[model samples]
Target chain A: MNILRFITAGSVDDGKSTLIGRLLYDSKSILADQLEQLEKSSAKKNDNGEIDLALLTDGLRAEREQGITIDVAYRYFSTPARKFIIADAPGHVQYTRNMITGASNAELIIILIDARQGVVEQTRRHSIIASLLKIPHVVVAINKMDLVDFSQDVFNNIIIDYSKVATQLGLNDVKFFPISALQGDNIVDRSEHMAWYDGPSLLQFLEEVPVENDTNLKDQRFQVQYVIRPQTDDLHDYRGYAGKVQSGIFKKGDRITVLPAGISTTVTAIEIGGKEVKEAFAPQSVVFQLKDDVDISRGDAFVNAAEAPELKSELDVILCWLDDKPLQTGNKYYLQHNARTIRTIVRTLEHKIDVNTLQPLEITSPVTLNEIVKAKLKTAAPVVYDSYDLLPANGSAILVDETSNSTVAAVLFR
Target chain B: MSAYQLNYLEELEAESIFIMREVAAQFEKPALLFSGGKDSITLVHLARKAFAPAKIPFPLVHIDTGHNFPEALEFRDQMAKEVGATLIVRSVEDTIRVRKLTEPKGKFASRNWLQTYTLLDTIEEFSFDACIGGARRDEEKARAKERIFSVRDEFGQWNPKLQRPELWNIFNGRIHKGENVRVFPISNWTELDVWNYIREEKVGLPSIYFSHERELIEHDGQLIAASDFIRLDPEDVVIKEKVRYRTVGDMTCTAAVRSGANSIDEVINEIKATRISERGETRIDDKVTEAAMEDRKKNGYF
Candidate 1:
């Protein structure tokens, strides 16, 4: 079965965790023993006779004590149709960095909107982040439908308001669902209360949504991770470059070029687990043997010579500051792109994104924690990359602090 | 451009291989924590594929509780040889004798917790900057919150709240001297996924995973494996049943399930029909408390 990795984002009390809990509970994914424990804990917490489904995703003791999700918590469940991995991110603006981290690898995103309030500020901020991250599919779940008497008018009004934001952000694939996560309506099964609505349930939409076509197959990009050389007597003089195929298809006799070094070679062989394969595609970890010996090392990349990526020493990037230390001009960091890590300096701060209004604010100060900004960066050495709009896996990078080595920013090249 | 994407198992394998390569490139001294379990065995297989045509870059470290199944020990030795990797074994028996730590006694006595001390000692002795293990998020609630590259303090304690934010495929494996990162490459895999991978890859495992007639004793509604370490009480009834282990841990604490699965295919089918979780049916350590896994992980138990 295919795996659908998604994220749930919403403001506090919008029931992000409750929605996930409902999905797990309604699908029979929650085991009997786990349900029993949940009941006991719910009774102890005394949530006014209501089982707090939020407690299920709040795994850390600190999160449980604070009654808020502080970090990204991953939850797994599977139906007969597909496997689901949910990255439940905190909704508070201060934890926007956590949301970015969760949404980075997500193929789809479920943005929850409380029915009473339509298209609030948090909703717009999250939508902008989703568009910025290039999430392929978006599901705006209008939660707490029971509170609004399951009114189709309320759901429709919210959709009308949300559509404008989606249009402004250039989100092409947006779906809407009205559901009561607490009362089990239109989440797993259809809701009888909403006779006016005619659409697949949330689970149904997730099961049918296509994800495989998102991979970039026209451009072949493979970053060499490690050099494999078995220096034993029997297998002497054997050298191979091992890595995951980031994009496109590679065949045994395909002509490939080693990046950064600019050496051309032919793929002599492609092996997966000591067995030779005729061809491989994106996301398959394989080792390639070249016909001609080349000086390739870790961080070097290989691509189809006809469709090579842009190679440059400077870049314009959108960065989300993740560390507590503010990002300032002239501050140096280790820019890690694929397997390569190079020394980088912030040459200029173009502007900080006002997430609330979706406007570019002139930067008068350094970028602080949880702030997103577009900046120009200069690297010490030339690097090979594509626009993130073209290829996400190869175009994206991270800025690590030189001294602490902590990832301080998420970089998207333009 | 043809539409091609990896299946679930292939995607998992690719991600794991990527993680293994990151550990190899980022850390100074790394080791694969081999426990002779199915998960760790799969990890070794991935590591082999990660750097094929070359010997595994890291050594295999085993914290022997000295109560291991004979088959597991033999399998561990043979696997180390096949990979041509260095094998380092640290014994809990020696640590107990030297440190004067008292072992739990009576019917439920187990050396499982004692292995932590030897493991921590081995890390310090070898100055290993990173230790890769086969821990999946689906196993326990605490594991669900763990980072792929989990950072441990000098004392080997996990601070869940202080974990660094892991984004995309980029993992932060930086730490000071004496501190280490515990890497879990298969964090996204479920129990069924592991079994399916094993079946597809034809990975070798200990014979005990297959059904065989063994002497067992019933304790607290569980079929406890009859072994020298287990001190059966008067009420405990011994029986000869065809059983297979869903997970292999300390023999004293690992329970067995009645099954006729003698091959990998049968095991996969049985697991598909099984209702209980792998740990729920086998591991006794996690049943101690609601947050037992979390507490143990905080104290540096892998």
Candidate 2:
């Protein structure tokens, strides 16, 4: 089954958690005892004897008491056709890091908007981040249409406002749906309230959407995870290289290059779970036995000799600052990329991006938390990597503060 | 290898292999947590594939609660021999006998929670930097929030609020010397996914997973397997039923469901029609509250 990962972003009271709760509840994903406990918990919070479905997804105790989402709460549910992983992120401005983390790998991002409030800064910020993260799809769910008397004009107006924001962020494929998450309209089933809107329901869109080709298959990237030397009488001197194919495909007899060493070899066999296979493709964890007895270890990558990426010591990157402490110039930290890591220093701050306006500001100092900026980093050693836009699996990196050992920023090569 | 796109199970296998390799490369010393269950067995299989021809690059750690099924113990030994990986077991029974821990009372009581102490002691003794387990996020609520590389403090406790921001495909495993990481490559897998992957990969499992005649007693609306450890109350009634375990845990807490799924295909079909979740039918501790798993996780229970 195809897996569709999505991130949900909206204001605190925009009914994001309630919508997720309803999805889980209506789909029969919640177990018997879980629903029973939810009923009991709802009864205590019921001012007018109505079950607040939000309780099912809003897990944090403080978030439940405050009736707001505080962090990214990941929820998984599946229909027969497809599986869904929802990253329900917080809406507070301070939790922008959480939203970035949630939407980083999302194939689709559902940006919730209050029907009454046509478009707000939070909505634009989410759209900006969705674009910055290169999330392929965007669904603008104009929620609370019932509160606006199910007026067609209200929904149309919100769509127009969202389009303008989407345009500013260079989002090409943005979808709009008017939904009343509380009333279960235009969610799982078609809504009788809006007969004029002829788009497929949210569930239908999710089921039929093309999510299979989201990964990059053009670049053949394989990071050597471990070196296997089977010391047995039958297979004595058997040395195999094992790891997952990050992208593209590899077949027996294909010419492959070992990175850092620039040694050439031919694939002899592919073994997945002890069985020999003819070939391997992206996302398959299969061990490859090469023809040549090359010296290889962990933290090395194998690639097509013709299309090997650059091995460089310096990188220009767009970084999303996630730590409380600012990224000071000339500070050394660990830069982890794929299976490799090395000490990296902030060479210079190029420009700080205003997420809302997409404007770059020149800063002589370091960038702080919740800010996106472009900076130059110099590593102690050369690292093999691709542009994040080309191969997301190999392109991305994280900056860890050496002193605190905390991940302070996510980096994308520019 | 085939013309068709890689299926979901294949994808999960690839991802898990990637994580296993990361653990070996990033950590100084790492161990695999083996529970003799389908999930852990799946992890062991993936680890083998991740470093084929090279003995798995790490040892297996089993925190024995002393309430295990005999079949599980036998299977664990056989699997270790077959894979050629060293198996290390730390018993809670020894911990209790030596006064390192106290045993709970009554038939309903369990040493499951106390196993955390034994596991911590084993980690401290071995100085393992990373311990990979077969925990799935879709299995419970608290697990849903766990990162692929979850860092535990020197005390072995998980702090959800202070968790590292795991972004993109990048996993940050850097931690202090005392702080260790709990890695779950299959954290995103569901129960159905596990079964499907097992079938697709043609992975071998213990015979207890298949339907067979077993003596069970009804207790707290659960079909607990009748064993020497279980004390029969006057109100309890035993019956012989053809049953299979959906999940393999301690014999006392893991329940058996009436099934005729003698094969993997039959098990898959049965699971599709079943209305209850896997934990709902198999786990006893999860029945107590909605936050049961979350609370246990916060207390350093894996």
Candidate 3:
């Protein structure tokens, strides 16, 4: 069985929570005791608590009181064929940073919409953000179909509007499904009311989505986490480079180049748990032994020299300001890319994105909280990397303020 | 190693190694919270894998309640020596004498909660910036919300709302001087995944993890192993049974289950078929309420 991780984002009342609740309830993922508790809580009358499917979610008590999701709540459920991880994020405009944090590693983004309202500002905002974050798949779940009498026209209209926005961005794998989460239609099972629709159910689509090839496999990059040296009598001369295979495949006798030093060596062995393995691939943790000593240490990248990534001293990044403080221009911040940290300056703020319109606001000033902007960065030293479109692990970085040691922003190099 | 395909276990192993390195690189003084349990034993093995061909750089710190299983104590010393890592023992008995923690005058009363005070004292004594634990989210509800790099305040209190947002592969381990981070490398792993990984990695755990014939007493719908620390009641009759511990903790609080899972494979298969959670069978503290684990977490019980 495969594992799929997705993030759901929309406005507060756009039926985002209802959709997830419906999926969990319909799939028999909810425990019997938990459902009984939910039923009891829903019956207790107070501000939409009665029969409020949203109550099934919104775990935090404070979130329930405020009637909003304040943080990213992760939920897991598995069907026979695949397992699913839902990074349920807050939908408020103030929590856009939270959405980015939740959707960073997500392979799919579920953008919910109300059929009665067609397409709204928040819908376009989240879709654009998902595209910018390079989410591989986007499912536009047109929710609240029951509110619009389960009208196929209402669903079709929203799809047309969303298509225009999705085209402006580079998201071609966008899918649409009309779902009545309150009535459990077109979510886990097909809706009889929407006979005009001929697509798979939302759960079926999620299960069948192709996500294995999402990671870049051409560029074989291994960032040395730690250099293991044992002074034991049996293995005194042993030296192993410990790290995860970020991309591509590594095997014995593969010629690899160690970054920051650029010395080439052949792979002698790959060890997982004190034993040698024949091969390792992306997302696998295995220690590598080089045929020759190349002075590799922690924070060094090992790559195939023939297909090596570009080493750069500066990068133009699309950054989301995460901290509460405004990102000051011309400020020096430490950029953590992989294991290495280098001091970098905010060279130029190209444009601050207007969340509502998805338009670039050409600004030279500082970016405030919950704002996304493109900026040029100049690093103190050259670091090995790749384009975001090519390899996400090597392409992305984060800015940390050296003075306070706070993560100020998450940067995706363009 | 390459003959069989264990993709899920391998992914878990990869992520755990990444987290282990992050703790080593991010914290000033990091230590492993070893409790001589299967989970901690698996963690020690992963730590060895994370730095293969070298000894684990971090020291192992165990907050002994002095009510531990005798087999667990012997296993702890042997594993620490095998890994060649420094082991520091802090006892709740010390705190019970120095702070005069009240002892309950009952047969089943345990010193489980007193270990928290002793653990906090150990952190203060060592000034450890990060404490690596083998806690998995699938253990209980409260653990599900834990961040990979969890921060505790100066008083060692966990405020879930104030947790820092952890982005993709970027963990922020910065905290105040008095504050420390509780790092769980296996936070996403489940109990089945742990046993499967252990089986595949050939990690050696204590012999107590295997099924053995032991004297047991029935209490609170659980099968409690009779130990030296446990006093028998007049009505509570002792019977010999074949049992194994699902989890190893304080001898008084950790219960045993009727099982014949002597090998890791049998243990994994048993866990797969078991309807009750690991904590439900072993941890007495978790049987109180759904929020019991959360409350303990708030009070700095790791």
Candidate 4:
């Protein structure tokens, strides 16, 4: 089976946790013991006197105390066709850091909308995030359909309003469904309440979505993470570059380039899991034996010599400032990309994004917690990367504070 | 979908392999914290694949609690030698003797807590910047909230609230001089996923995982083995039953289930049919409190 990693764009009030709980509960993923525990710990029960479904996603004591999710908690459930990893994050405006952190690797985003309040600020903000992260799939689940008498007009109006936000942000594959998470309507099975709807249920759409083809197969990029040299007599002279196929395929005899050094080498052999394979594609961890000995260390990129990405010292980036301390211009940070770390200085704070309007406002002050800004960074040396818009797998990095060593920002190269 | 796409297990393997290689590339001195359990065995397997033909780049560090099942130790020794990887064993008994630490006393008192002291000391002695373990998110609730690259303070304490925001799969593993990062490559995998991967890969496990005739004591509906480390009670119901371990920790704290699953397929089926969570069904140490794992994690227990 395949895997679909998605983020639900709502909080407890929006019934995000209830939707997740309904999915897991309806699919029989929640075990008997877990259900018993839920029954024991539920603080809020519905009129039916059943366990609160929202308790399923709350993990920490602090979160339970505050009755809110503070961090991204990954929940796993699977049907026979697919495995789903739900990055359940808080939807309030203050918790944008958590939402973005959860949204970074997600292939899909479920932007929840209450039917009564058609398009709230959160809907636009989440759509902006989906566009910024380039999440492949966008879902608009118009919840509380039962409270609205399962009206088609309410569902269609929300869809019409969400489409404008989706178009403004350039979010693709916008699929909408009318669901009542509290009553389990149109989540796993088609709802009898809404007879006018004819689309597949949320579970059906998830299982049938083409998530397997998300990898970028055109751009060939590899980074030498570890150089394996056995010192024993038999394997004395063997040197291999161990790394994942970040993008594209590497055959046994393909020509490759060693970046930052501009050295060229031939692939002598390819090995995966100790067995010599003819070729390895994207997402496969393999050891590449080069034809000649190269002075390559960790963080050195391996790409096709035919299509080399320009190595530049300056980068135009959008920073999601996640720390309490403000991002001071002219301060240095360690730009970490994969296993490689490079010194970088904040050159300029271009602008701050107003997520509500999907517009940019001129920055007058240093960026602080949960704020997104357009900025320029100058690296000590040239680094190799693609634009975040082109291929995300090979084009992302993080900013690590020099003194505190905390990850202060996520820098997406534009 | 293209043929290049990998299945769920293969995808998980690729992610773990990438993380293993990342640790090898980033840290000056790294070690694989091996406990000879199925999770660690799966980790060792992934590490081997991450750097094939070449031996695992780092040493396999084992913090022995002096309360281990002999079968696990034997299997550990054999597997380390088979893969030509170096094994470093440090015992909790030695740490207690040298550091003058007190051992808590009870009927089934565990050295599981004391093992952390030895682990921290070993890490300091070696100046290891990273320690990779096979901790999964599905095992416990506290673990679910932890980052894949968990940074521990100078004293090896974990701060759940102070964790760095891990964005995408690009982990931020940078730490200061005294701090070290605990990397869990298989953080996304579940208990059933591990069993399925083991079955597909045909990875060898310790003999205790399979059903065998052993002397056991039934306490509070849990079947525990009668080990030398455990101070059994006079009223303890000791019986000889065919039991197999679901998880492997110290012999005193790790419980077994009465089963006839002598094969891997049967074991997988039994796991699929069992309703209780993995840790809840086997680990006695977690039953002391609802936040037992959380408290231990705060104090540097893996």
Candidate 5:
């Protein structure tokens, strides 16, 4: 079975946890002992005389006590068709950076909407973030339908409203499902209550959604994570550049360019698990030997010399502020991309995007926690990267504060 | 877009290797926390695959509780030598003598809590900046919320609130001195996935993982192996049963399952059909409190 990494984002009252709980429950992924513990916790936490499904994702003590997810809690489940990794992000407005963290790796995003409220500011913000992250698929689950009497008019109206936001955000691939997460409808099974919605359940759609295309299989992008050279006498001449194929495939004879230094070399040999492999595709960890002994180190990328990504000192980036410390222009931070961390200086703050209207707003102050801003960055050294939209795996990076050593911001190369 | 894609297992392997490579490249001094369990063995396998032809760039450190199965200890020593990795063994027995640590007193008393002190000491002793663990998010509740590159203070306390936002494949391993990061390469792999990987990779495992005849005592409906580490009470009845360990924690804490599954294939089959979670079925430590793992992690327990 293939893997599907996804994110679920909605406000606390939007039944996000209930929806995840329903999927795991229906899929028989929850074990008997876990169910027993849940039953005990539900009795103590829930006064509604029913199991508290939200308790499943709220794994931390502080989160369980406050009834708020403090961080992104990853949940795993599987069926015969697909294995899923759910990045359950908190919905508190201040936790937008956490959602961005989850959305960065997600192939698909499930944006929940209150059936009564339709599309709200939170939905718009989530959609905007998904678009910014370039998540391949967008699924809108208009939940709490049981309260709405499974009204077709309400569902259709919400779809119409969301589609406008989707169109504005350039999110063309969007799917809508009407259900009640509390009542276990339209999550894993068909919602008999909403027969007007004749579509596969959310789980069905997730399993079938083509995530393979999300991986860039055409442009060959690879980074050297480590240069392996055995000091043993028998294999004295072995110098292997070990890394994963960030995108596309690398054959033995492919002429690739070692980035930053821009040295040209041919992949003399490819070995996976110490065995010779003719070609290694994207996401496969393999070791490569070059014809020439180039001065390649960790963080240096290798790409097909013909269609190589740009190597520049200045970069345009959309920064998702994550740290409590505010960011100002000329402030220096380390930009960590794939395997490379380069000394970078913030050149200028262009503007911040108003999440509510998706409009460019001038940055009147230093960017603080959870604020999204567009900025220009200049690296001390030449950096090799593709635009985030063209190649996300090799393009996206994280900004680290040199003082606190905290990941300050999520940098999306533009 | 093309149709060439990797299966879930292959993908998990690739992700793990990526993280392992990051540890090798990012940290000045890194070491693998080898527990001699299936998870750590799988980690060793991945580490070997991560830097093939060349030896793993880091050492394998094991914090022995002195209450482990003989089979597991044997396997740990043998495998470390076989892979040409430097094995650093720090015992809680030594930590107790030097640090004057008071051992817990009970029928199920263990060095599980005190082992943390030894681990922290070892970290300082070697000045290891990163400790690559085999902890999986699917194994426990608190681990689910932990980042792949989790930071800890000098005291080895994990601050959940202060976690960095881990975005995409980019990991920020930058940490201050006297603090170390716990890098979990298999943070995404579940128990089933590990078994599937082991099967596919044909990685060797300890003998205790398979079925064997052993003396076990039933307590609170859980089967605990009768080992010399524990003080047997009059009420506790020891019986001989064909049992196998699901997890290889301290002998004072880990329980066994009644199974005749003598091979990896049979073990996998048993695990597939089981309804109980891995910890719930075998571990006696986590059932102590609702946030047992969280509390342990806060104090630098792996």
Candidate 6:
């Protein structure tokens, strides 16, 4: 079965967690013991004699006490068609970092917009994040339709408003779903009340959505993670570069070039689980044996010589400041790209993009927490990278606070 | 034409292998924590595939609780030898003796929590910067919030609230001198994913995982294997049942479920039909409190 990794983002009380819990509960993913525990907890909290499904994803003690999700909580559930990994991201403005973290690896994002209040600021904020993270699919789940008496007008208005935000953010594959998470409408099964609405249920869309072609199959990029050499007598001469193919396809006897070193060699062999294969593609972890013994180690990239990625010491990037401390110009950080980590200095803070307004503000002050900004960075050594629009896996990097070693920023190269 | 897409299992394997390789490349001294369970066995397999032809760069560290299943201990040793890995065994009994710590008593007593001390001591002894384990987020509620590369304080405590934001596929494994990282390569995998991978990879596991006729004792509605270490209360009755272990831990606390899954295929089918979770059915340590796993993890338990 395939795995469809997605995330849910919405403000507090917007039913993001409730939607996730409903999906899990309706799909029979919640175990008997877990459901029992949820019931007992609901009774203790006296949730109006109704089981509060939101309590399922609120795993932390503080989150339970505060009745708010504080961090990203990954929930796993599977149907016969596919396994789903849901990153239930906290929706508060203070937890924007959490949402970005959740959406980083997500292929789809469910931006919950309360039907009573269509397309609020938080909804736009989440849409910008989904676009910034390059999430391939976007589903605007207009939740709490029951509160509005399951009105089709409310749902249509939400779709109309969210469509503008989606277009502005350049989110191409945006789908709108109208549902009430509390009443389980248009989630697992089609809602009879909404006969006017013609579309697949949320679960049906999630199951049938094509996630296979999401990867970039036009550019072959592989980062050598480890150099394998067994000095044992039987395999004394064996040498291979182990890594997952980031994009495109690599076949046996294909000519590839090692980045930074710029040396070309033929792919003598491709081995998956120690068995030689004719070819390998994106996301497949394999070892590549080169015909010529070119000097390559961890942090080296294997690319098609015909289409090498841009190599430079200076890069213009859009980064989300994740650290508590504000980003200062001329401060050095440890920039980690793929398997490579190098000292990088913040050259300039160009402008900060106000996610709420979708406008870039001139940098009059330091970039603070959860602020998205376009900046220039100079690394001590040249690094290989692609535009994030071209290939997200190879185009992104992280900024590590040199002193505390915390991941301070998420870098997306332009 | 068939679309070139990796199935869920293959994607999980590739992600795990990437994490293992990251640990090797980022850390100074790394070790794989082997528990002889299906998860750890799968971790070992992924580690081997991550760096084929070459032996695993690091050693395998096993925190011996001295209450392990005999079959599990034997399998651990044999697998270590087969992989040509240096196996380092640290005994919880030694930690208990040296620290003058009293073991828990009565029907719910288990050495699972005490294993934390031995594990921390082993890391300090070897100066291992990264300790990779097979912890999956779907195991328990507390584990759901863990990052792929979790940082621990010098004292080996996990502060869930203060965890670093892990973004994209890039994991920040940098830490101060005394601090270490606990890496979970399979953090995204579920129990079913592990079983499917085990079947696909043909990974060897201990005999206890498969169904067998074993002497069992019923305690607090849980079917536990009757072992020499567990003291039976008068109310508990010992009987023979065909059972299989869902999770392998200290035999004193790990519960067994009645099953006829004698083969991997049967086990997969059995798990597919299982309503109770892997930890909910077994793992007596997590049954103590709602935050039992969190409390133990805060004190450096794997």
lDDT of 2 by residue, A128-244 (tens): 899888898999998988999988999998888888888878898889989999999988999999998899988788777786577777789998776777787888988777777
* Fnat by candidate, in order: 0.58, 0.62, 0.30, 0.77, 0.93, 0.77
Q: What's the lDDT for all of these models? A: 0.89, 0.85, 0.82, 0.88, 0.91, 0.90
Q: How many residue pairs clash in all the candidates, one count each?
A: 0, 1, 0, 0, 0, 0
Docking class of 6: medium
What shift in Å separates residue A27 of candidate 4 from its native position after superposition? Answer: 2.5
Candidate 5 residue pairs in backbone clash: none
The root-mean-square deviation over C-alpha atoms between each candidate and the true structure, in angstroms, is: 1.8, 2.3, 3.5, 1.8, 1.1, 1.2
Cα lDDT of model 4 by residue, B1-302, tens digit: 68888889998899899889888877889999998999999999998888888789899999999899999999999989988899999999999999999997987888889988999999999999999999998887788888899999998999988888998777777788899999999999988889999999999999999999999999888998987778877788779999999999889999999999999999999987887878878998987766788888999987
Q: Interface root mean square deviation of every model, in Å?
A: 1.9, 2.6, 3.6, 1.3, 1.4, 1.2
DockQ: the better of candidates 2 and 3 = 2
Q: Cα lDDT for residue B139, model 5?
A: 91
- What ranges in model 5 sit over 4 Å off? B1-3
Q: Cα miss at B201, model 5 (Å)?
A: 0.6
- Candidate 6 Cα errors over 4 Å, as ranges: none
lDDT of each residue in A1-414, candidate 1, tens digit only: 778999999999999999999998887767766777778778878858778787788776667778888888888888887889999899998999899999999999999999999899999999999999999999999999999999989999999999999999999999999999998899999999998999999999998898878888779999988888888898788898888899899999999899998999999999987789999888888899999978889899999878999898889999999989898689889898978999999999889999876799998887999888988999999889999988998989999888876789999999
Structural similarity of chain A in candidate 1, as TM-score: 0.98
Evaluate every candidate with DockQ and list the scores. Answer: 0.60, 0.55, 0.35, 0.73, 0.81, 0.78
- TM-scores for all predictions: 0.97, 0.95, 0.90, 0.97, 0.99, 0.98
What is the clash count of model 6? 0
User: Model 2's DockQ?
Assistant: 0.55
Candidate 6, residue A231: how far the Cα is off, in Å: 1.4
Give the CAPRI class of candidate 5: high
* Tens digits of lDDT, candidate 6, B29-112: 999999888889999999988888688999999999999999999999999999999999999999999999999887656888
- Candidate 4: tens digits of C-alpha lDDT, residues A1-414: 988899999644888989998998998878876787788668343356678888888878787667788788888887889878889888888888888899997999998888777888788888888898899998889998988999999888888877888788887789999999999999999999999999999999999989766788778899878888877799989888888888888888999899989999899999998899999998898888999888988889999988776688899988989898999899999998766789999998889998788688988777999888998999999989888888787678899899888889988888
